[model samples]
Target: MSCRVGSTSSAPEGLWHWLGSIPHWIYPTALRRDGALWRQVVLWISGICLMVAVTGFWIGVLRLRWRRRYVGGAFTPYRGWMAWHHIAGLVGGMFVLTWMFSGWLSLNPGEYFAVRGPTRDMAV
Candidate 1:
């Protein structure tokens, strides 16, 4: 059985495919060079994404106070809020994850995956 990491089970097919292919994509991008403007954009997007992700995650998870309907659930009037919260959190989390990695690379272009100078060839 495939490990349903994070919110994978609920993720859309297209997104799932992309996420599945991350290992293949990461290396190439990690080594590639990015321009200054691109880096700024990445940083801005990452910041926004992180904020949205955290807020949504909190909202999504906080609703867990209400358990099974038949069982003794949390005594709250707004029980249905959980579903929407989860959806919002999932969406936000996806964007946040992408933005974060890309932003890190953009911010530290030289540091991330920087290839060292060629090593001197040892005499045979």
Candidate 2:
């Protein structure tokens, strides 16, 4: 039989019931309930951090390119495309790295890993 919210029929236990009641748009496979103010704060902070890292990378690339053209001063004077390419690649790489790390931390909080054993106290 189809499931219904707040139903008392042959439904799953507390955890499963809670998981099933989540909205479909956010989580079709499982429930994703709204978080408290703290969680929202963390998310916003992570987002801002990601943005800062990306911006730094972009600026670093620009600095590197400028340094190469004026500082290196290759006698032959080759095309400047290589300088731009090298800096852009480095910045993009760093951006992706920061994004992945922050994303993982956001998905699972630190407390989740602090659990020692099955019988360990979870109230803390």
Candidate 3:
């Protein structure tokens, strides 16, 4: 079976194919110039994406009206790109955060979250 590592099984064909790649690919950093610069670019972009996703999602949640609808009887009190941003933020933010975080973790800048090797007495 094909590993559904980042599958969009819920969406119908021709709709979710492109969006389905986000979680798996996250960013096209790997396809960039293969050198030290690429690593830094990935780290920076991942960190930024994670932060933006978190903050945007939080704001969207705050502005989301489940019980009392908005002016147009809509759940969101936004229109145009704002509306798309709000909706997309709520829907795709989580996935973006997940993939971005995983990408960031792989980079592990400053070695802050880096794990030390097994102890001498530790079993192989």
Candidate 4:
């Protein structure tokens, strides 16, 4: 039948309900019921990706800066595909770092503001 959209049940019904139910089909009911495990998995993967991205970024930066300087100039390293590879890695590493960091933060959502609680009395 008909699915309720807002207060009315006369809403157009095609694949909207099916599309919404896809998540249920993909993830197990237990995982859906308790999101802690899912969040932990996401955090672990994102953390690992973040570390890899950081190291890759450092290696790319170092190679582009120091290693290429002796050959000729930093920008003009190789005369063919290798030069493009170096440029791509340097640029792509920054994007990867940002994406992984954002994903990690998403799984570990926290409050930015720090509110202090009541302090204990010195007399007590």
lDDT value, candidate 3, whole model: 0.72
At residue 77, what lDDT does model 4 achieve?
54
Winner on lDDT between 1 and 3 is 3
Ranking under lDDT, best-scoring first? 3, 4, 1, 2
RMSD of each: 12.0, 14.2, 9.0, 8.1
Per-prediction TM-score: 0.37, 0.34, 0.49, 0.55
Tens digits of per-residue lDDT for model 1 on 1-124?
Answer: 2335566455466457556665333322543356555556555656665667677666655555545542345433244676555565567777766767675665664455665666566422
lDDT assessment of candidate 2 = 0.55
Q: After superposition, how far is residue 59 of candidate 4 from its true place, in Å?
A: 0.7
Instruction: Give the Å shift of residue 57 in candidate 2.
Output: 0.7
The C-alpha stretches of model 1 lying farther than 4 A from their native spots are: 1-34, 66-110, 116-124
* Candidate 2 deviation (Cα RMSD): 14.2
- How well is each residue in 1-124 modelled by candidate 3, as lDDT tens digits? 1234355554354345545664345444455547566667767777877787788779889998989998888889999998998898788887877877877888778778765878767855
Q: Per-residue lDDT for 38-113 in model 2, tens only?
A: 4555555566766676666666555553444553564223347865665565757676866656674755655575
TM-score for predicted model 3 compared with the true structure? 0.49
Please identify model 2 stretches exceeding 4 Å from their true place: 1-35, 66-68, 74-124
Q: Backbone collision count in every prediction? A: 0, 0, 0, 0
Instruction: Give lDDT per model, in order.
Output: 0.56, 0.55, 0.72, 0.63
Q: What is the lDDT of residue 62 in candidate 3?
A: 95
Clashing pairs in 2: none
